[model samples]
Target: MSLLHTLAMHRAQLPLNALRAFEAAARHLNFTRAAIELCVSQGAVSHQVAQLERRLGTRLFHRLPRGLALTDDGQALVPVLADMFDRVGAVLDQYADGRFRAVLNIGVVGTFATGWLLHRLDGFARACPHIDLRVSTNNNRVDIAAEALDFAIRFGDGAWHGTFAEPLFEASLTPLCAPSIAARLSSPRDLAQESLLRSYRPDEWRRWFEASGSPQPVLRGPVFDSSALMVAAAANGLGVALAPAAMFTRELIAERLVQPFDIAVDAGRYWLTRLLSRKESDAMRSFRHWLLREAEAETPLCSE
Candidate 1:
């Protein structure tokens, strides 16, 4: 009957599981889907939501004939619960192997991921074992905030809107192809006679030709969405590919592909970018430092 006792009882009666069930159900607007996500039966999810509604003394969702719709109260509560869960999950993830391990989610360009980062990732793991790294590879385009990524390694001029960028290294574009194709190319002008395999960017071959002091030729090669595939096509003797020669070190060393000319054109550099609105976490800072150090060691001639 005491005020303090009543408050304590109220706190004790707060159902955490029911709250989570309701939140998940509300997010999906479907009890069945929420049950699937929570790995429970639909009846259990419905019961939890019903229990939560009774406790709160209000209806949080409307049970439609086909789907569910959140009430005003539910809409207001969803974000708060979501944030609370996220913060708690983040804290829990930080503790591993008797040490704090911060989770860092980064999106990298496919070219850089395959060409450089994947090969040297072991070194990063050794250097910073306390950081949990989750990497996703994308094309040059990405939405850092929408994807909830901590950092994005992309190829550009470091001018993305609402992003802070640090240059990693320059990936100069050059003509690469199978040895059979390379043997026929005595001059940059000779590229006109072969199938000039192209990437999404149409001006790459033109830029290389201009840099080589050769007149730009009319290109009628197949266009690929990724440099990796473009290089693969060239290695298979389909056509000459204009790509970053440094990225295909393995192919070049194995004699699967060869650079016919020494000339390379700079289109853009790889950059470590994060949204300006995002504050750097401990893990992000650590990874950024490690990346910059590695870039410096690998490409001493390239400047940030």
Candidate 2:
């Protein structure tokens, strides 16, 4: 056979219904349940799955007295079909209002995502109705290119190589704890008696102590990777968390947490970044503009 003819005969794609039928049956492991889900008769579902097995030259399932069990080959194919169908469905949903809504994917550190961005996303949605957003959160350590993200919001010095960076705001670290714990902390010196919750960054509490001109206390409490979780632990009366006070304003306002001292350590800043080679789409541009404006309203870009 000619090369092109041979390739055509063994192409990857099969009939859509056959794949769908096999996938649904594999999920439920029972023809009746799969039929109910697919709105088809049990006999039809059984026939389709059987036909799929024949076409693939292998038995996809083992007949059990109570239900079906997928073979190794069937196990491998189920997730592939599920992911493909989900992606296809997401794409189809974007076609509305006679135009496709541009999809933008972004990764954000948990602190900024929960403490600041989550509260303002409603405004972003309203302002850009034609743009669809997909957000994933991390612990300030993320690979934007590997994750296939359009942008990433991280906490650092904005000195990452091979990326474009925009400074959002300085998140000065301060001591925060529950109201009960705050009552005992008359001064920075009083923190020596309590547990000191900390993030992976080892120098935050030390810098805050330097800023307050107080002797550094021993930090042997539980270590956390995200500031949000560390503060949550503090709110639960576990310990005193040194974090960005401005980010946890809601907890302070709601009386869940208390900032015990005015001294804050300017250890790092929040930044929006993208890979140098990433091409900006219309959705990306819209989001960038909106995000920059929001950041400016909170902390002006020129304020340093």
RMSD of 2: 4.0
Q: Which stretches of candidate 1 lie over 4 Å from their true place?
A: 1-13, 23-47, 60-87, 96-98, 300-304
Q: With candidate 1 superimposed using the best TM-score fit, by how many Å does residue 186's alpha carbon deviate from the native?
A: 2.5
Model 1 agreement with the true structure over 121-174: per-residue lDDT tens digits: 999999999988999988788999999999999987899999999998876887
Encode model 2's per-residue lDDT on 62-147: one tens digit a residue: 98999899987778777877988888987887895678898899999997888788989999999999998999999988999899
10 residues in a row with least lDDT, candidate 1: 1-10
**Per-prediction TM-score:** 0.80, 0.82
lDDT of 2 at 108: 93
Q: What is the overall TM-score of model 2 with all chains considered together?
A: 0.82
C-alpha root-mean-square deviation, candidate 1: 5.3
